[model samples]
Target: MMIGPTNLSLTLEQLTGTDAGSVDEAPTNMVRDLIGAWKTPLDQLTGREIGLLISQQDGYPYVLDLVWPMLEDDPLLEAEFYPGDILSSLMRADDTTWRDRPNYKRRLKALYERALRRPDDETEALRESLEP
Candidate 1:
């Protein structure tokens, strides 16, 4: 599917290598280009783009990793979702989607734990949301 207002044809499957059996350069480059495009002051990604990036399909883990570093950057200020809301949503994506890639799945979990421990503006509400 198309991402936000961009003319690029980024689909959920391409967001992660998913069934590619090995890492190819195109998807990574596509993601990189998307991020690069979004980072421009006039071209920030919308909440829907973020949602699509961290979507429940193949987009979750791999795209999550790619975008994780952007969370603390200026891009966060331009997005529609709160930092807490985005982090919590990323943490809650269906973990089972990548059951075959145990290590990758673990990495996503680690990101959540790291977020919780980092004491950022996001994790406080995320921690409260996950409370039992």
Candidate 2:
């Protein structure tokens, strides 16, 4: 299902065990509010939660644009898992319609490059994550 900000807020509340409210705020606003309420490092969230955020059907693009960047430097966000999952998901979503979304391609390319630069041990996992 398409998960917009309100849905995302609910999901975050469920996952993080905090009440971030169900207001239909913009994705960025909801992210900000959730972060504030979470009070913990974003990377403290498990890989599964990060995967859910990246794989959301509706606001995935916005989540990538806004939230992903924030989590990029989080030590808890494993490079092999998080970036690989995001890159794989982005590539899977890139269809004929993706051509019109230059920003998406740029972000996808950037993530791919970042994944490639991971350490040898992590790179293996990244490669495996991308494989069909």
Candidate 3:
């Protein structure tokens, strides 16, 4: 079922044998690569777990959290896999399932807040648009 962000992080760490310090210490590109490589986990997981993973991975307060944003944003980045499509794919099943999770929404709000705090030229516009 749908794991909360806390549970999802715990589970993924358990499954992958990765720790917070290690995940944090790894080079940004390496983390991006790991996220990029885990596309299979995103698809194979249940909807809830998938949502959890998405929330946990992209919901962080650091730019490091945004990484590639989705598998399609990797070398395979293509117009065919529009941003929404890539986000949908990461959430598994659909955006409906992702939005239904209160935990995901909470994390998303936190992420939005984080994003607003240290925006660059590119994200400044996104931040303004995202804020109320």
Whose lDDT is greatest here? 2
- Misplaced by over 4 Å in model 3 are 1-95, 128-132
Clashing pairs in 3: 2-48
User: Number of the top candidate by TM-score?
Assistant: 2
Ranking by lDDT: 2, 1, 3
Model 2 weakest lDDT span, ten residues long: 1-10
Better of 2 and 3 by lDDT: 2
lDDT by residue (1-132, candidate 1, tens digit) is: 222222224543344323333233436764654444333222244555665455424343444444555654422222344545555555565756445445545566655665666556645556775677
TM-score attained by model 2: 0.46
Q: State the lDDT of candidate 3 residue by residue for 11-123, as single tens digits.
A: 33354455434434557854643454343333244433333444444433211132234321231222232222223333333345344254454444444444435427524
Between prediction 1 and prediction 2, which has the larger TM-score? 2
Q: List model 2 lDDT by residue over 40-88, tens digit each.
A: 2343544554555555432333344344554455312452354355556
The residue ranges of model 2 lying beyond 4 angstroms of the native Cα positions read 1-47, 71-83, 96-101
lDDT of prediction 2: 0.49
